[model samples]
Target: MQILPELGAAVASRRKHLGLKQGEVAAMSGVSQEVLSRFERGKVAEFGSRKLLAILGVLGMEIQFVPFIPAGSLDDLRLERGGGS
Candidate 1:
């Protein structure tokens, strides 16, 4: 699964749902705003897992590993599995 896009989207959505700006999340996660912005937009080539975990921690989010078969993109797989945001 192309986890970066899906994970980024979830983080962005959670951050927005919490009424937070990128800078706030970046500061809380100890990541630069530029990196956070790039990550949110799914433009980042690679991101540190610790940084990602920190962002998720700040957003009160956690990663769940479902049964994934990698049929398509993560979004497609989620849809196929009836996962909701």
Candidate 2:
């Protein structure tokens, strides 16, 4: 459920699949190479949304949010099933 690492992996995989270099992507996305590197490394906790969107744009990708269970929902289900929370 760690979203950042998943996102970073997705970017890195797509970038590689597209045969794109970090420098090229950085320039195209208007982000620094170091920032791109860090993002690809899953160090994106501090990265801004604008920068992330810009990078995704350069990679011909888009971000989407999916609906999911809220906090404690899983625990509630577990307890209902006679399982420990």
Candidate 3:
């Protein structure tokens, strides 16, 4: 739920691809076993970004952002002030 399922899947997939165990990943990432278990089960929202980053780092992953649209498009929009023109 809440976009966590994809994250969990990614973590799980990456972990398996790296041939790492849950406990091993937890130890390497400095996250708790319970938290890692939950995350692999698609409960990533329960964990914070810091913890997620730690886990992802151990999995050889890092967070990155990509813009979906041009920045100027947002600034061109105007909000209605009231009934007045």
Candidate 4:
């Protein structure tokens, strides 16, 4: 959920970095320009994961998930639950 904005920002940044317009991305990825605009605005719920992945592939980006552990007390609890010794 929180990653949506990050993903949008990454897409926007990458597009800009590559000097590509939204139309170019839309054509390359075979997604509608309207959808690409929505994606850039972080309205990711409207698009399917496969379409998003295709668009990202054109941008030379891939999604990666890294497990996140909260700091302080939460981290301790996670470690304990995982049998850390």
Worst 10 residues of 4 by lDDT: 69-78
**Model 3, CA-based lDDT:** 0.81
- Using TM-score as the measure, which candidate wins? 2
Give per-residue lDDT, candidate 1, residue 62: 87
Q: TM-score winner between 1 and 4, please give it.
A: 1
Clashing pairs for predicted structure model 4, backbone only: none
Tens-digit per-residue lDDT, 1-85, candidate 1: 5779888888999999999999999999899999999998999889898999999999998888778554587887788889944
TM-score of 3: 0.72
Q: What is the lDDT of candidate 2?
A: 0.89
Sort by TM-score, best first: what order? Answer: 2, 1, 4, 3
Candidate 4: global Cα-lDDT?
Answer: 0.86
- 1-85 in candidate 4: lDDT tens per residue? 4767778788999999999999999999999998888888887665678888999999999888799865657668779799665
Tell me the lDDT of model 1 at 53. Answer: 93
Q: Which is better, 2 or 4, measured by lDDT?
A: 2
**Model 1 residue pairs with clashes:** none
Give all candidates' CA lDDT scores. 0.90, 0.89, 0.81, 0.86
TM-score of each: 0.77, 0.81, 0.72, 0.74
Predicted candidate 3: what Cα RMSD to the true structure? Answer: 5.8
Model 1 superposed RMSD (Cα): 8.9
Model 2: per-residue Cα lDDT over 1-85, one tens digit each: 7877888889999999999999999999999999888888997677788988999999999987789976778878899889985
